[model samples]
Target: MKRRGPFANRRLARFCHEEAGSILVLWIASLVAILGMTALVFDIGRVQIAHGDLQRFADDVALAAAAELDGRSDSITRATNAASKLISNPQAYGGDGTLSGATDYTLTFLDGLPAADTTDPSGYTTTDPIDATLVQVVTTPVTLDPMFLRATRTLAGVTGPAQATVFAESIAGFSMEACDITPLMFCKPTGWSATQASSIGDGILLRSGGQGAAWGPGDFGFLDVSSSAIGSSCFGLNGAKLIGCLIGAEDNVTGCYAQRGVTIEPGQKVGLENAVFNTRFDQFRGVMSQFKSNANYTVAPNIISGLVPQGNACGWNNVSASTNSIGLPHDNCFATGGCTRFGTGSWDYANYVDSNYGNRNGILEAGEDSHLVSHIPAAFAGTRYGVYLAEIAYAQTAGLPSGAILSDRDETGIAQCSSNVSTNPARRVVIAAAIDCTKHPINGAATNVPVDEFVELFMTEPVGTGVGSPPSFDLWVEVIGSAGVAGLGAAGTGGVFRDVIQLYR
Candidate 1:
């Protein structure tokens, strides 16, 4: 063993006590903490960026899905398809950078949303597609691997979650507004459902409600088209305004009615304005006699009303008894005055064809008859509306001119009154709001009366005050089906609906 002197022992003690390199030791010790903190900040920022990307994706999906909730039976299916296929966005940063699709998110159709965003959606959501007006979308959770958090935790011997999960959720609502719609509202027939296939082709007798009286099923009233309800376009004479709206011209009433509610016109709206409505049949009468050549008040291309000329205009009394007349007849129950409003979809089809087209057998041999038969099902062949459409088709393809005389009485399917006939056949179809009067009663000038649905009504015949004409306040129309149905010609094309979609959360 070697022995150290006192001087060497003193030098060793001083070196141990020296503090010259103390800062380097301290800095080395803190380097691990500094790196861990940096890693935490970077990982947190990446997670936040991923969350933001997911939120944007959710918002887009919700909007796309909500736009298809049009109160139809396939609303949910349509919405799901729209959401799954319409939107495709890539989530980057902390996520795996995958494109979004049906599998990336889950959708919930809701009839109503809770008052608070934090409320559970299971309680308010619905499986019924027709009733769902809201949609909620939640993205699948994305697992993130932190850049250094896991390694730092392992080195520190800390037991915790190795990976972080992040996701986003959003809610949206859909609403509809009917723009450039006719200013007409009628009580929905009892037990009528817009989605019911059986409701189509039924005849409906819409009668005007007495002034200041509560409206009921089959009763109709004018909508408030005053400047307050619509806009400045309808600021003229009350009669003229009403006639303009009924005419449905481009320069006429300009406004949109929300599906949620509408304002009822005030005062006595006595008649259905037979003169204005008669223009559609090419039979101008009363005040409408002067607009015979006006394009705005054009007549339907096929104006085959069963009336013979009485002078310059056709008279309602000229109609033939039985099925000799080409005009669409009312339901048997309605003709007998037994049914008040809705018809039982039963009519005299054979007699009608026998009288107008020389029997169904002869007409079936005509050109394009096979095509017509295929389009008009046998079940709908008896319907007044179906027959009317068939007549128009026959006139087009069977070499029977639009103006060709149908009966010996000089009743033609052409507009003799107007030179510029309406090219759009829907001129005779009135789009009216159907309201559930029992649910939301209307006394007089009701505000915000909820509408059940919008119905497309085909004018079965012209309104007139003639001896044989229906009461001026009564309107006879055949149900073409509810507007916005899945597949019902132009009415199903969503022309009446102005959809609005918005994000809730």
Candidate 2:
């Protein structure tokens, strides 16, 4: 070194020594900082993983709670137990990593829905929605602290704490339909004895004030008569007086017929009035007297098809009035209408059979249609149009074990009522639900009562008696979610829900 001033040399020496020690101190400080930052990252990542696990556990607990609810009892306790088994820390407190001042979780019940009365006016009932019956179990929310950084106030600004919470919800009940049976079985055709034929009306007498023609025993013949187009004309009948005759071979004159025979329409219920037909005009005079009969008769025509009968006293030749009895057991036929006395062709006879009788009611009269077992009576009448069944017994079995009473309107605009079917697999009450309110009906296999249990229950009970009456129904449990039993598709999905529940008694 060259000769230098004392102040300059001393300053240079101090700079070298002091600055060298300062660099080592800085390096050591930076290493410590790096280690602390690395430790913080580890703690944060571990806590994040734990939080995710707890969240999944909460979800599992919710599903468990719903399943327990399906048992039909003890819902809240079951939910709590299920939650404890799922979450890691059963008693984990909610808050900023502190047990104090935390929001406690709890399991609770949801109230059920009200019942419904669908009887009397109509024959169906319904249940409430599923969302209204849902219950829930929730866990207490808590705040967790970061392990490394939280220990020091200086690192507080680096990371923040987070809160965790979990929640779960579930649903659970059966559905039912029934009918009513009552008095008045019309003409017991199926059960009647052969000797019962004597019970038909005696000598036919036209009840006064009634329209149409009536006939008593008489004989007459026609020949060489004056033909009239629209009015009665004179004709030689047994060489005596003649009236209302048309002599033309092919002429069809209204109120004037002395030519040939008439052809009755097919599928028509006809009434005979001591009258016979001649196929040819040449035979008209020779067989005129053969058209007569010895018995006095009052004939009435009724149309029976399917399960209904259509007729009015106005169309019958000798009906005193449009009587309601014709639609009842004695007057109506089950398979066909009326008797074919003089001629025999393609005749479809009436066949009346039910679980009650198991056979035909009798031969259907020409003026009558469909003669099945007379579960209803002719003299029977009701204030309203409906079917009523009473005094039915209920059993626990799946099969419908009872019958109901019914009252229905007749063609004469009267209410005809009837009842009395046995209780067994053979003769159970045919409880039916009408799709439309206006028309009386029963459940059909396709568009109506498709379910076996539903049909059995309905047939066992009375579906309110009367033409337009509905049955009584009770709506009980409505299930939802994976745990619920009332929905159509697989449970657990979001769409799983019970839209309707119907019960019958």
Candidate 3:
């Protein structure tokens, strides 16, 4: 090399001192940090989206399963099928895509849940299908291969698990609201279940208690149709308004009642016309005479009460002792006054058949429908309600002859008061809330009294004047079954149950 010049030495020294490219080195290092931050945000967003998808799936499955919990024997089976087979949804972002089969989620049936939503779900679960009312669903955990996080980790020369797992859970329950039900509630007998198999077809004698008297088992009272549960139409209802609600043709005029509880109408409400109850049997008398023509108060298609009209007037005199009169008799225990509110299902079936159809063997001479006969037990011929249905079928097949006249009465199943006859056989059946009187003491004007269950009662006879010195308003009915039971064949007939499903979490 030649001897270094002064200019070259100065240029070299100036070049070493200059800071021109220093910023470029810092910028390259900052790029790595910026990229890592962007990756973190993107991965977090994907995980959040996946969590949202899982939550939705869990909610839908819970609702579907809860809808099928109707307190039936097959409730859990139906709920499981509804949950696994009825719903299919797609999950995007980080899930396994489609959620279809049982493997995609887990189900837990619960009988009770803590009132609060924040409570954990481990303790309140149930295995019994009939008692299960709430349902819980949890999505299967899904492993996610994070798009940005994995690349960020690789670039950093980091090894180990880089995937994320996501899942969600939800709870739901089923409830019912009875609509268009009769404004009536009876004291539930000791140890009565909603679906009491033995109690079906048993005669129940419902008597209205004295004003201000504490109601006990077998006593019944009117419901406050004016309650908010019944809506505004029946609000502020008084004496005449109460009668109108009782006689209204539209079922919803009385409004909807919750299964939880009901408000008791304040008074004993004495002197309600017998005609009001008789209208269901097509016997319109007193105040009910004018409503016969109106379709709303249409009489039942079969109105075969044992009592003959008194001299063509629309009134029934005492025909209970008459041999020719053949109405469905009260239980043998009732005539003797040996039983309490409930009567042994043993009524004189042979006498009923002989007095009405001239058949002593309890078999119709004309061809009888086997379906109707199937419901009648061999030991008792038929239950009062079962016989009532069979009589309808009998009248349909064999033209009503003078011999088949009900209880030596000119009145037959055909309505003479009006041509607009009620075709619904369930017209004679009314839904009544059964309450435990001991647990909930009701005198009058009670609020939010808990109901044990709703029951379907077949009117065995029209409301009648009682025989005691003070006299009572007595109604005789046969228990059909608990409302909405599949075995009863009367589910949804009386607008007794309206099911509602909702998510809890």
Candidate 4:
């Protein structure tokens, strides 16, 4: 309005010059807001990442425990140790906080579980196919303490120092069953036909054994029997009483004579000297009794080791002897010629028996003509008569252990025959095996690398009668990855990956 000159203009401009555009205050305020937001995001993200990591680690530990529930002696201990080792340093897996609180987890067989039973008149309803109990695998709660987030003292009053709990659970079926022993190969000295016998005695001789009865024939130091014979004989004496019989003329010695099958007097022990005792019986009545017993027999590719050496020995060589063997044969009717078949190819082999050691031989030869056929097949059965052995091998590439545990909580060393079932026909023996993901590598890689690691094995008994008959059994095996857990769970944390396997022999 005054229309001043250049000097006037300069004075006015200076006076009008305001600090509005300096923006120092606005910039500082903006910086404070942005920094605060960033800090919130960083701390929250850190806590979240830690929680996620803890969960993942917990899962892995649980899975390890679950895998150990196969009813092994130290399986639970091993799995617990493995779980702790897996997360010993959770930070490696991106966990920002340390888990504190309870240590030690457990893998155990569940008790009082309802037996798998079904009542469908249709006779086609699927019963609880699983014969054993459920295995419960529990993982201890993993607790994590906040580290990065704790700095916000304000949160101490709000939510308090962040704490988290992680858990995992899994179920496993009965890993083991009672020991059952069935004859893989058997022959009454009279049960064998000339065609079934070679110069090597009766082939019907089979073998079996367990914890207390580890004695085998070859191991028989004083007996000096064959190992193969002891292998089978080990099964016979395992739980039975051992009393040596005097080898005198049948009728010549009555007082010192060993009654046919009387219970032995306590504290009295005897041995048959100068004579090797086989299952053979000379009496026609004895021969008839042996033939009428129900004794199923079959054979596998290899012999399983029991408490005693497979060879025949009774505290003789190695402590125990095998009752079944190709060398030392058990015969009820050994005539001058050899094993005599009842009818042409009428001899049959089965695992179930109706009598104990005393009377088992009575029907050994007359199985076809006696009550052996009337005996109903038991619901549970196994390949071997009284004992069942299942061996699982993990290649060095698989991450799993090379050994497996039997149902009886036995670690069954890396060798074969570590797992055993009863030969009784009333029981069944089933084997399910998988290669360790850590030990058995796929694609020839040095390590199996993580995938759906799994392997399925099939066990079967041949369909034929008599010990000398060729074994004609079939088994199927499947190998897969994560799918293996279908029988088990594979949650990667609480999941148990078990390959479902069935045994019907």
Q: Distance (Å) between predicted and true CA of 285, model 2? A: 49
Ordered from best to worst lDDT, the candidate numbers read: 3, 1, 4, 2
Per-candidate TM-score against the hidden true structure: 0.67, 0.28, 0.68, 0.27
TM-score of model 2 (CA atoms): 0.28
- Which residue pairs overlap in candidate 3's backbone? 326-407
Candidate 1, residue 21: lDDT: 74
lDDT, residue 372, candidate 3:
49
Residue-by-residue lDDT tens digits, candidate 1, 196-227: 76777778888766545687888877776664
lDDT of 4 by residue, 1-505 (tens): 7677999989779868967756978999798667656766775565566555554544555454444444334644554565556544344223334542225334443322333443211222221222122334344555554454454445345565555455544443323111111111111222212222231122122221111232221111111111112222232431111111111111111111100011111110122121111111111111122211212111122222223333322112232322321111123342333533211211123311212111335344444213322222231122122122222211122233432222222212122321222222211222111222122222111121111112211121211111211111111111111212222433121112323222110
Tell me the alpha-carbon RMSD of every candidate.
7.4, 26.3, 6.5, 24.1
Tens-digit lDDT track of model 3 for 149-240: 99988888999979999999999987667667777888876677647667777888898765578888888877766643443444465564
| Number of the top lDDT candidate | 3
- Better by TM-score, candidate 2 or 1: 1
* Clash totals for all candidate models: 0, 65, 1, 131
Which prediction has the highest TM-score against the true structure? 3
